[model samples]
Target chain A: MERKNLVEMVNIHKWFSGVCALRGVDFSVGYGEVVGLVGDNGAGKSTLIKILSGVYPPDEGKIYFEGKECHFSSPREARMLGIETIYQEAAMVPKMSVMRNIFMGRELARFRVGPLAYLDIPRMEEESMKALERVDLRLRSPHAPVDELSGGQRQGVAIARAMYFKSKLVILDEPTNNLSVKESERVLEFIRELKKQGISSIFISHNLYHVYPVADRIVVLSHGEKIGDFRKEETSVEEITKLMVLP
Target chain B: MRHTLLFTLRRALLLREISSLIMLLVVILVFFALSPLFLSRENVGVVLEIIPELGIVALGVTMLMIAGEFDLSVGSLFAFCPIMISLFVSEGIHPILSIVLALLLSLLLGGLNGFVTLYFGIPSFITTLGTMLIWRGAVLLISGGWPPPFSSALPTAFLVGRMGIFRASILWFAGITVLLWFVLERTDFGNWMFATGGNQVAARAMGIDTGKVKLANFMLCSLLAGFAGVIQSFRLETTLPSMGGGLEMEAIAATVIGGTALSGGVGTVIGTVIGSFLIRIIDNGLVMARAPSYWFRVFIGIATILAVILNTFVRERARKMRC
Candidate 1:
């Protein structure tokens, strides 16, 4: 059967200094599919995401987005292509306001297209509000500093920013690690909501309970190799957990 | 929380600066009261001459502190720049060309200090301190033990703030301070500088090239120091190799005393001006009152510590409230 790839990483080999990290690995994610990527500890999950987000470069491999070969030198390049990644550590300025944080790195400029033109604060606020509206939280003020928000609210804001970029692909890495039960459910709900919008997602989590329900298909990796890919309805959690832990 | 806030505000308000300003006032009054000679036009004229040149250097240092960096060599540059100007002017070179040369050299030296610190990952204080000694030594090696004398040309002499209600040095200082005020309060670069100092990683992630901003700040600071040096040399009509000695401390003290937070990201040029004037008055008064000059420095050191403690209390409280 021929596979229609949305994002294809072909023979991706990665190394840090002299230590081998990921060796000749191939993976792909299709559009409008909620894919769960599961692996044991030190299974190079972060390394894979880092390479995808342009934090690290693959020593060997070509990443083809929509079948177009691309090389990213920096995180900014990845962001421009709407390939948004929210790491376990939220990449945001803690002191800046919600509006500024939402528009950080990319700002709406006001005035007559001059070098001295002012920042379009109004436009930024408008967009920030719209983004927050999608989250549907009681965050009444977008001007409040990020430090003032709760952990779940902060996570919501990060997800909102990724979604607002008109992202075709969203990568959430361990989004529920520190969250409360309700908060985790909220994030899972948001993931389901994204799937309904026809936006594809790569949901990474070691929590099988959280991973199994929302995932359309679960991709399991052992050491540095792809172990199996099973449709959600076809595989049991115990079988996947066994595959995850089995040598 | 209320108690903490009240405690913070009290400390911040009753800062060493409050007493420093009062001390400046008391010193002025005492000098005037003690001898009619102190209040005379000639004596008053001498005191006024001190404000502008010192003020400009302090202003630049204030900005550097706000940006969370320091240029210790500014003091050496201050003396060396004037000496260079004198060296050229006394040798029959046009005064304007010599002035330009002195400032250009100052800018170049400052840029070197800034670029080396930012690009090479060396701390600014270390880099500028090294530059400071080298520049001062160069001035000494060239001028022998003494300074060269400039021509008794009226224009060159007056350029140091020898004419008008104030010295040209004071006017230049005021102008620069105002310009810096406009830039800091009005420009995107100003906001970026604060963000840079507050958290460099976030600033870079936000696409602001924080390294370049800091590098430019260092150059700007050193240029001002050099400007002050040129003023001192030309105004005095003489070049002493040791002229810039201990000036860095005074500039730093003035900045801290004026309300510029040494911890960075919060300071004002206006406060620096107030601080510089306050510092100059203390020195002048100490001299006039026949007190030991050592007392001035000792008080400034104490004031420095006091100001920092107060600023810390205020910031901690603000952080708690905001966060």
Candidate 2:
């Protein structure tokens, strides 16, 4: 099967002051595929994602998005290019409503009636509702403050927000870190839906079991080096675990 | 049938009270209980007048606070703004142009605070704290140890003072507050301010540009401070170097006591009004009751503590209920 590459990293070198965080790492995520990124605590999952999400530019490396090399000074620049990131603890504002969170930085302004820049609240509510529905959750109120939602619900909202924005590449960092069993399943199911939309994703997790079922290709990183990349049908969870722990 | 009944009972809650609304009730009750003079026609007029200026200051500080930032220089800026406007007006500059320039200058001041904080990655609290001192020094320098000739330039009936039904100051405050409320509750940018302060990291991830939000908030805060200064100059018919002395601390206290978390992400314009009223009433009552004027500070401090405790307790109970 032929796979089209959506993202490619070449010799990505990142350092914290002088200490090396990522050293000469190379990897690629294919288009329309769920790619798993597994590693230990210091395996540089966050560093890699930050570089990709434009949180921190790599010290030295080439990042190509859809066959063209690029560098982003900030997350907003990255987002404009259809790349979105959802960190475990930092994805949605707790005080903002579900619809506001869905639109957040990106909102559709209504036809300017006069001096006021009116928000198309009805349109936002409609869009947010459909986005929530895609995750199989019916929202009681579009105006529900995110802080009121439980852990599972918050995660659901985060995923839905990312999807609603029509991102081509959605990066999930430890998506189910603090979630319950059911919530984890909900996340997995959403990843499948992303597949149906042909939106590529990079799912980072400490747990190999969680990633295997959702991921089509598992890319194992240990101590910031790409150890192995294996197809789901070709590799078992045991092999992925052994590769992670042994390194 | 019993389970359904219990479920319905559990689902009920005190309608989500805007923190200010709840505080306003407490303030009215306490003031009314303490003094009959509080409800007098003259005192009512005083209350109405005072609430607006504080409301204007609160609206801007509310913006800064809601963005998870602080501005301790508003009082100083407020003093400086009117002095600048008076100076410009005295030079025969058009009042409208002078107003625009004053507003722009306020924006520049705010932008400077924001640029330093975001670019250097400094906490806004520290940046504003430093800026407040600097602005206060500048205000003193401009006054040249002499009070501004505010009386000569300002209108006694229009800008400076009022008679029977209306005061220029009251109208000024009301206009600003209405504009602020419209900006805060009716616009998308207003929503962004809340979200930015609520979770800086999350706002950034969502491409909300938390830096820009903070800058805008700071600018708005200073603009309000400046606007109030003009009205105050008119009211006092003078601008002393110490005109808006400690107004920053007062505005911040009012905001916090009104239920805005000093740490940011939760606050309201209405809440600040209640907070301002609480502090102001306490000031008036303490004086009427023959209490030490110094007690106002202590009362403000205590109110801050109570507001935080109340907020935490309410959140905890709400969490437990969910469980």
Candidate 3:
């Protein structure tokens, strides 16, 4: 069986001021594929994903989503096309309730009269709980602020939100960082669940152990360039780690 | 069992205005004990009448603060709008047209503030401070240090008419409060404001137009300040270049005392309403008790700090509670 690519970035290049961040890096993810993107700090993993997520534009390159070339001017534009990116330390609003954070930009309105509509609070609360349950995250109330939740729980909420929104490509940047052992296990499980549901995910992390079990393929970057791309069956953890640290 | 009680207490405090409400009651009682005239009809009327002038401005400031921005120029806009309205009317413009023109000017000034701040990435505190001085100087330049006489052709009954121990401005104040409260609590824009203020990076990642949200709030804050000034001018029948001079600080104080977070992303309109009343009552109560007028500022400073400490204490305890 042949799987079609859900996302394709050809020769993407990015620059900040006078410094080069990414130099002609090519990346792609197939439908229902979980790709582990690992790199050192400033390996341009965050920068690459930021460009794909429409946080900014690539200096040179073309992006094709579902076989169609697309340009996104803002994160909102990419979101409308079903690309949900959860950034490292940029997932949930700390002071907002779990339910509110889940429905932050795309709120459920009971009745909208030209941007003057009341929130469907009951529906949102119920839907958020169901979404959290899907990620196996249980809380006493959805109204509790995200600040009180553990790092793992916060990631759970972010994952639950992506699941609820029915995103085609969910990009998670270091979703397991600062998490306890149990919490990180839960997050890896979430990636497995996302694949089970036929959703493509790009999991960016620094830890190969965390990404190995869940990713179907591994892509390695070092100093703003791709050095290795291999199937999980062909590549061992040590091989990828060596490539990541290579001068 | 003890946990449930603590949970309930936390929920009650999460409402965010309870402490301010309690302070308001305490202040009322203290003044009532200190002076026989504390609750006199005239003194109560005076307090109620003036509260809306500042209350309306505070409402807008609360929304702006919740969106993680500031508008120190609101005080200047408060004076500038009315002065503009009076100038237009004297120039033979219809009274209604004059009011509309003044509000439009407010939005323009607000938009400029928002544009400069967001585009240049300057902190709103500095952007609005610069605009504050500019607008204040513009007002003085336009008015030439004298009050402008306002004789609107429109009926005074429509605006500040006496409504039996309350001026119509109180109704406007109440109406604006309800409108803004609904906008903040029940609407998508309100949620956006909270998310924007709560965490800009997170909000942006979630696909929110945080810049647009903050910009709208900046304009709204100025519009309300202008409208409140118009209301005041109608009551006074003149526009003072020095009107709303120190009002910006008072409005910010009201928001802080009402439990709105100084850092943004946490606030409530109802809390601000209570906060506005608390500030006005304290001012009126002291005067009725024959205390020095300077005591108002001293007392407000203390109350602001106490309210913040109380709110912080309650919030920290709530956060530590096990779910």
Candidate 4:
């Protein structure tokens, strides 16, 4: 049986200045699939995801989303197509309220006259609480700044934002880094929640232990090249770790 | 029960303007005690009249600061706009047209400042610093180091005319403050400003045009500075190249004292309004108390430092309480 692919990138190549970052990398995510992208430092995991998320355009390749060839010039354009990328340590504006952070780029305006419009604060607040509840995150108020939330909670907010936006694919780059043991568990649980909703995600991580439980398939990268792609049932954590570290 | 009490106290202290408000009250009380004439009607009116000039400028600076940028060139633009207005009027342009033209020039200069800062990837502080010198020199060259004669028959009464005990400029200041407050607190642009200032990387990753946001703020800051200069010139009926000299520092000080962070992403126009009044009152109170006018700078310096320290301490406490 052939699974339907939600996103497919074929022979993607990226170069920064004169240094090659990715060389003809072919990656794809199936419908309702979680792909744990594991690689060592400088293995091009981030570069590949950055290309898919529209942070950088691939020098040579094509991206097909839902069987349609797509071109993205900016991150905004990609987001408009139901692709949400949560970059590590760049998820939410710390000084802004949770509700504001949730609706940072897409705000609900009561009425827009020219460029001057009032925010629909009541509706935003109500929706924010509902989204947080979906992730089991209860706060005293939606007005509290995200800076006050714990590390795990911040990731929860980003996940909730992706869920609320009904994103077709969420690419999380190193989402579990810098989190405590318990907090990492919560983030893994979020990946499960995303999968339950039939939302596909690319979970990039250096820790195999963290990714093994949540990811349905594991893809290993070595120095800008895809070395192995295996279903979770057919691969072990030790096998992926060896592939990531082998020269 | 004790935790609830601590939480309430921390929350109150965490309010952005509370420290500045407390400082304003303290300064007012100390001045009133030292000199009974500090609260006299005439002296109060004098303070009110002077505050709008710097207050209006600070309001713009506060907005720009919240967007995570700085404009040290505002003082130069303040003087430059009015001089241009005077030059236009001398060239037979209608006073209204002259004012509008000068304002447009201000917007252009501000946009240039933003363009240079963002395009070259330089700090706005450095970018505005260079433009500050350039604009100041332009003012000197244009005005020839003297006050340009402004037309007294330009129907300026509507702008700076006296209404009972208050000048119309005061009303302008209040109106601008209210409008900007709404824009900052209730609008989508306001949220973008906070996000852009708070974390540029996060904002960009979220698909916001941080460069555009900063550019808009830069233009706005210069426009307000120019407008403030126009108000002053209308009141005085003259334009001086040296006018608003050193005013950029005063406006920055006012914003800092009002709890606007130097690092950006946190600030309020209302706090800036209180901050402006606080600075002016200190200046006027020293005169009323028969103290050297130089003490005004000393007091402002002390007030700015104290307000920041208090705000930081309170904010740190609130953060700890949350955990």
The global C-alpha lDDT for each of the candidates, from Candidate 1 onward, is 0.76, 0.78, 0.90, 0.91
Candidate 4, residues B1-323: lDDT per residue as tens digits? 88888878887888899889999999899999999888888777788788899999999999999999999999999999999988998999998888889999999998999999999999999999999999999999998899988787577777788887689999999899999999999999998999999999998888788999999999999999999998888888888789899899999999999999999999999999999999999888898889999898999999999999998887787767752
Candidate 2 lDDT for residue A29: 88
Q: Write the per-residue lDDT of candidate 1 for residues B86-185, one digit (tens) a residue.
A: 7787777887887888888888887898788887888888998898889889888888978676556525544564575566776677678777886664
> Which one wins on DockQ?
4
Tell me the docking grade of candidate 2: medium
- How many backbone clashes can be found in candidate 4? 0
DockQ result, candidate 3: 0.81
TM-score of each: 0.79, 0.87, 0.95, 0.97
How big is the positional error of residue B26 in model 2, measured in Å on the Cα after superposition? 4.3
In CAPRI terms, model 1 is classed as acceptable
Model 2, residue A199: distance off in Å is: 2.5
What are the DockQ scores of the candidates, in order? 0.27, 0.69, 0.81, 0.83
- Docking quality tier of model 3: high
**Rank order by lDDT, top first?**
4, 3, 2, 1
lDDT of 4: 0.91
Local accuracy of candidate 4 as per-residue lDDT tens digits, A186-240: 9988889999999999999888898999989998888898999999999898888
Better of 1 and 3 by lDDT: 3
Tens digit of per-residue lDDT, candidate 2, span A150-195: 7778777877877787888999888888888987888888888888
What local lDDT does model 1 show for residue A94?
A: 63
Give the per-residue lDDT of model 1 (tens digit) for A132-245.
778665576787778777766777887788778778888888888888888888888778777877788888888888889899999887676777889989989999999888
Off by over 4 Å in 3: A1-3, A15-20, A59-61, B1-6, B152-154, B321-323
How close is candidate 2 at the interface, in terms of C-alpha RMSD after superposing the true interface residues?
Answer: 1.6
